[model samples]
Target chain A: MTLAIEPITPLPELHRGRSLHNVWARFVNRVAVLLCWTSALVTIGALFLIFGYIVYKGVWALTGLEFTTHFPWFDFTHFHLNATFFTSLPRPGDAVGGMRNCIAGTLVLIAMASVIGIPVGMLCGIYLAEYSKDNLFSHSVRLVVDVLAGVPSIIVGVLAYSLVVRPMGNNSAWAGAVALGFIMCPIIARTTEEMLKLVPKALREASIGLGASKFQTLFRVVIPAAASGIITGVMLSVARVAGETAPLLFTVLGSDQPIFSMNSHFPFFHADLNNAFPSLTAQIYKYATSAEPEWLKEAWGGMLVLIMIVLIMNIMVRVVTAKKMAGRH
Target chain B: MSDLPVMPPAAPLRRRANSAWLRFVDFLTFGGAFGGTMTLIGLLALLIGTILIGAFPSIHQFGFSFFTTSMWNPVTARFGAWPYIYCTLVTSLVALVISLPVSLGSAIFLVKLAPKIRFPIPSALLGKSSPSGWTLLNPRIFVTVTSFLIELLAAIPSIAYGLWGVAVLVPIMQESIQPFLADSVILSDLPLCGWLPHWHVGLYLAHIPGIGILFADPAAGSNMFTSSVVLAIMVTPIMTAIIRDVLAVVPPELEQGALGLGATWWQAMKLVIGFSKMGIFGAVILGFARAMGETMAVTMIIGNSRPSSYSLFSQGQTIASLLANQFNNADTDSERQALYFTALILLMITMLINGIARVILLRVTAGGKHK
Candidate 1:
């Protein structure tokens, strides 16, 4: 049997008139589109402009003008990396030397913060994702976490001062880490919960059907599957807290000496958590606000380093997330 | 047959022992997680408690007059949060004013315009599209790069912004922007003249009883206006990201349906925006909270002066900046308590704003999912 197909007729075009309403609507659409494009360009342009200015000033501060003596010709001798800027301790009376202590202090503080933050955050995330069923307790925890995330870092500093510093009788790395950890907890928890939620329900059911306990299933299967995402969250949180200056202001209080010192005996490295700790952000604040011109240059250099670290981490996370999204599809 | 059926009651005791151990482990893990969550709640409570305790002395001394009075003389021991509160509100409101339109426009562009404009690359030059048909140079990639750049703005340390404000923005504002605003006759005559203070006409209108004291001669580079601009820049990325997410969640069919019914692109956008208006409002509130709590950058650029006037170009202080400047060097116990009192107020304001924003945002996003 042959099927007969009828020829299709296109619908007649509707009357296209330049009425007042149509014209006004078209004009508004065009204006709206133009405004959107302009705003996007402006936002991107501002980012580039700020980044460009920073890079220019930062490079000038880092490399100095000594290379100008051999301008118009290639000379490798005068162009040397600012080694002293990263290696030596900051000098007094004159703002000279490097931010070695600050860098080391920042690292120590971050390590301490991660130690306190990661487990608690991950566990709380597990609780929310695997156990809670929209109950009041879990609901309140979520709300509190959101609120904590929004609380000003400076207020956290005040909390640290009152809770740790006042009790300890001085500013210390412990207090700084606690403040940073407080900031990191909610961020880490939020991300972890989100990541865990992304894992398929089938995976959990399969593990459970295999006779694995809930705890075993979470630790052995679900967590492993979501490991990379959780790591990304942790790194993002680290990047965030690494740049926090206010929270460290009264907590660590800024020091010229390194937070850790080498000892001659076994377990040689000693961390002085009892005293003020040097931190990159706190030191940057100090240098930027100081009266010395050289200190300002140092501040710029520190900012360049800090920005590089943060941007690199963020870019890495973006790339990972993009890859994961692509892979999922 | 009896011997086969009797096959050793399946090691029931040993199986029970193993199961019991697993149950104990599960209990411990659950307890640990519960403790962690409890710690978070405790930490928040402790934070509020500490600030309240610290501020108690000043709260007792000043009474409710602290909220109404503007006097903050430390030597005389008379303290009030009125000026700081006023400045904080003004700065945050100004920042919201500056950032909202820019962020909304950017979000609209990213969500609406970007996906429609296809790049005409040879399919052969690019690999075969994935199952999802997304390729390099697709809208997703463009949006990703743009969003990443925007978020980089957030990742920038506040102190860096402070340095940039002091070294770069302040000079520009002082040399050009402030002067232009102060002298511009058109701006002075704008319909919102009550709010848009000006220098040229402000002098004549100063005694008119209605004109604002916002615009004045540029004093130092660091002033209320400059700080507000910095805060606007700081909050723009956050607002843009949230607004973009909120807009993205609106079902494409809604906009398409509007367009299919012969509506313009702007009209369709208006429909979608109307649908998610609560979410956008929440984003604005979130940005406002961020601006209110911002400390280091505002401190660096706000001139850190005792608040005296509402002039846009005049030096002023916000609660957070005041706390940053004075918390360390607070000479007297009363002064310290006063600073804490101001901090407690800031904490309460930000938390309240944040809570409201989160609830609104949650409702909107959840509603979208349900639909």
Candidate 2:
């Protein structure tokens, strides 16, 4: 005696019957997917739009175009490369010149900030990653670092003003570097800690088993293992501080000449750390807001330069990390 | 015992000497690192102390009224932080509102939809025969490139954004978007309010009281709304990156289970979102804090107007912007102190937001690990 078996049937609502509930659910799903696609496209599109506009306007500015009566079109006859824009000092009083001084000043400021921020940040990160155990002190220190990272650049400027500028009775390059250093410190420390933490425990143990001291192991083995990541972090932090304008507004107070000078006396490579310094971002701000079109053009050019520096650094870091990731595979 | 090798006495001494040197080096490194950590602590204390000491005069003078009153007469030396606080909150809230949906949608697209998406490629182009006529687009590559661009957006300096805002966005807002919005508000009052007024889909939206004022006429284009838009653009990438990270951490098994249970892709996403709601909220809060503290871009376009009405079309000043604009120009010590007081307020607000976000995110990630 055999028992009869029946085939399972689909739910009436869920079948391909074009039921209202099924249709509604499908419609909703389609709409959601469509929205997501549109949003992603829009985000990418917005980035492209920004870059496109910047490049167009920046290129126009770089070529030193003269406005023609053609209304919105520039005379290509005047489209010569503006070499003076990179080589000559900024000309005052309606004269269009270069941002050489400001560029130099910016480079000097970044150098000073890195010098002050990098080692200290790396050491703090080393302590957090290798030495300090989970304790209240370490926890509090981490908390402070997190909080400090969130503090606005303008506030840091104010702090630097009071802590460095007011005591010295002047806005100076030193004060600006301090403000930027403050910004760079927490970022470097955070990244360094994270990168160091990523180094394998087995490697550390191997070094220890080889009779290496903790300090030697960390410096020679762990740090080297994490070097690429640490360097990437440092580069990113430097890029971030490079374009900071608000802090420099209060600290460096823009200058017209280069912030450094050569002296024949002792300390021959003299720096104007005691005086006002110009920076690319701050100078761009000053020029961009001016009523003069030439100044605005220069501002655009300066922006192009600044953007190039930052984007190059970012892309380099990305490429390096990508290579490292690929190599791991 | 007779076969045991003899050890050199000089070798033992050298070994001892090396060990001592290593110990000394270890001590030095430890001391240096500890000093660096202490420096960080000292920096924090110094930051707080500087702001506190600088702000004491205003705090003493105004007492609690500094936060309550709206008056800010520099001539009379009467200062109030209420207006700046209000502006900061309003702008940041508006920015958050504008950015949240976009960021969420993009994040969902990235984590859920990206992997399933495939592009059809012609066999001729590929130089190979394919039965399905499709090629995997490598979601990993797509996601990496998209995220890299988003990060580049964030890497673009605030000052650069300000430059672009002044040169490009402001004019566009003044000429097109603002006028269109204002016109739509008027057009919504017509009989065909529901359908004819294309932009006035916010007809019922205009009936809302306080929010209605936000859709007012465009001034110089450097108004609160414009700044809020800039802030929105500034923060969307950050919020999207964070939300994508959080969403990516949701267990794939949970999503797969939902799908296997005959749920649609959207339904699966809804489940994942519900699971990671706390983390998403934390991302929003972090974005809000960033918007609040953003200075140069907002300052360039916010019109730097002192405390005015709450109209989004009206120019307003935020705490950070106020500090940026006035900190340098303050002629008197009290005036400088007032700016300090504003900075203190801004600091507190940001710290509170960041702290709450950190706690929520920590808990969410920790909970995920436990699961």
Find the candidate with the highest lDDT and give its number: 1
Expressed as tens digits, the lDDT of each residue in B165-252 for candidate 1 is 8988998788656665665343454444646656443233222344445775565789988999999999998999999989988999
Which consecutive 10 residues in model 1 chain B have the weakest lDDT in total? B201-210
State the fnat of candidate 1 relative to the true structure: 0.70
lDDT of 2 by residue, B5-64 (tens): 987575444455347788999999999999998998899889889999999999999989
Cα lDDT tens digits, model 2, A169-198, are 988999999999999998999999988998
A1-329, model 1: which lDDT tens digit per residue?
A: 89989889999867565678788989999999999998888888878877777776676677663334557536555556787878888887565678888988898899999998998888888888888788888888999999999999999999988889998988899999999999999999999999999999999999989888878898999999998899999999999999999999999989998667798987898888999999999999998888888888888888888888888998899888877787787
The 0-to-1 C-alpha lDDT of every candidate, in the order given, reads: 0.86, 0.85
Clashing pairs in 2: none
Who wins the DockQ comparison? 2
Worst 10 residues of 1 chain A by lDDT: A65-74
- Give the clashing pairs for model 1: B214-B312
